[model samples]
Target: MSRSGGRWADETIHRIMSMTKPVTGVALMMLHEEGRWRLDDPVARHIPQFADLAVATADGGRAPLARPMLMRDLVTSTAGFSMIVPLHIPLTGLVRSVPVAELYRTLDLQGGSLSRMVERLASAPLAYQPGTDFEYGVTHDLQGHLIEVLSGQTLDDFFAERIFRPLGMADTGFELDAAQRARLSTVYAWGPDGLAPSPPSVTTTDGSRGSYPSAGGGLYSTLDDYLKFARMLADGGRAGGQRLLSPASVRLMTSSLLPAGVRQHFGQRLDGLGYGVGVGVVEDPARATAMDAGYGRGTYYWTGWLGSWWWNDPASDLTVIGVTQQEGAAMAHVGLPQPGADLRALSAALVYGALMQP
Candidate 1:
């Protein structure tokens, strides 16, 4: 598939999925730099809809939260919002399949605004309270909504100005145009049943088209375009001599943000690995499991659901992206062998191998 004017031919368009989180994170950082919002600021400060939130309990009960959710909590996945709930067992399997419009309708029926979603989330209780544990879910999507509220621009527009346009990532967006759509790779899934095609679906509020521009998992991009964005992060948030983020912000975004115990749990195999704002940071190679084979420390990266991956290894001054659209059992079994050849690992291996060649 062509990528932003055919910069890279072998590489194709990637169904970015959750990797969209990092892109959204960058946009939030830009807004923070502009003084539009602060990390500690209450989300309700700008989006008043979130003033009173609640948490869910283990017994399926709910209670009011001691405080409103802070912006940092949403960025860090500590907000306790989940796309799945144990009580809603029947809906678990259909979480992804449920149209975004339907999801919103359910939320609306429950009298849940984005803010109320947080409140109800808090009252329902969390696997862990805000800032207590590391979990990944729809926090970034809330961040996207926060961006909409603060910037008065849609998440798509915010990303276009702060990230895509600056990094020359022309082929990155929540939706593709007709010509680009023709090049979209087919999504595939492997299960106990067998291999099957996984067609793309619109997952936005209203559902007609993706009006909600999900920051959590709503983007399609090509390898070359994504590479530019990765390269900018690798280059300390500057690309083409344009400073998109201050060096300090880049450092902050790529540095360890979690507590020591949380970092250890996530990076147990990697002696010096941790999660930064939106990327995984490798601090020590010796502790990393088999995944650290040829990788260096201080590597920052993230991946998409359909096996797409990208990394910025400051240690090597390199950035790489691998694109594909396969998930589930295919990923567990034939997707990539032994050291696991998923896009993230393969991309890292390719770059590391090339570095060792000379």
Candidate 2:
């Protein structure tokens, strides 16, 4: 899409950050279509390490989990996980020593692998019981691990062969070669001083070749490349004359699955919002009156920490993607209104508004 300042060509690659969750979520659903696993299955079934987990009580003690974390909980963000470091908990020392915490401080941490990340996550207590609340954490990262287990392929290989290659999303993946890196936009953080170049230590953009192929928030892609993925969803899972996912799977991915109580929290983020598989869906039109941006229901979208956003509204056959490398933009929304300052809402307004032409 074009902006006032200059052109954002189809070849420009940007850090998609958390936008990777939906992509990973789609991959998992593909496996589901093959009967490899069910959404309600306990995550421990695939990663036995989570067989016996704990819950972090506010009283400064640990308690046995009320129930196992279901696989659906991971995608829906109802698995009682939070991105917070939880340094005050009983295992502060242990948690700090784990490499996962290093990722919080900076993405430059080396030698840390996704396996150890899962092991560390298992050791930590859940913020709440599975399916009880909405908390975002390393849920999708665990999904990535499960994908590896079931597909017998690294996350990168799985994406390359299954999703990226099939959709012809040539510019989307974890690793970027030198040529790809050259086109990557610089990440900036809005701080006390002003908008300045974010520290290079933020992440290893060299590629997803690192040990941590963070399924939740790690991927790079160009505008046109990601548009293909989004439009595929908008077209009921078909793009380039190929069906990447069945219509039923696409419906399941975009439909509202949030618990009643959690629905309120989702609403708080965006009026009438509901948690779908890996993105937010507009569930209550009345409640969503403020932020619909002329888009109708059945609109599913998600963004990244570095201020990138993408959404597909099947009702209108429209897809919009905005990518910019701006950290600390929407610190409150966890980068939802990517590049901060309400750009996501504005983009929707402009796109849908223009389409209203006679």
Off by over 4 Å in 1: 1-11, 63-68, 84-127, 191-196, 199-211, 264-272, 328-343, 346-354
**C-alpha-based local distance difference test score of model 2:** 0.72
* Cα displacement (Å) at residue 64, model 2: 2.1
Q: List TM-score per model, in order.
A: 0.77, 0.85
Report the error of model 1 at residue 82, Å.
2.0
The number of the candidate with the highest lDDT is 2
Model 1 clash tally? 23
- Candidate 2, 1-358: lDDT as tens digits: 2212235666877888789999998898889899998878988888998888887666757788787788878778787765533333232322312333443434322247777777766766666677887666567787888899999999999999989998889989888887776677777776567777776566446554566787887788888888888888887788877898999999998988877766524212445778787888887655673455665777788877677888777767777888777763423343222333766666767887788641
Alpha-carbon runs more than 4 Å astray in model 2: 1-8, 84-111, 203-208, 264-271, 328-340
Model 2 scores worst on lDDT over the 10 consecutive residues at 88-97
Please, what is the whole-model Cα lDDT of each candidate in the order they appear?
0.61, 0.72
The TM-score of candidate 1 is: 0.77
For candidate 1, the 10 contiguous residues with the lowest summed lDDT are: 200-209
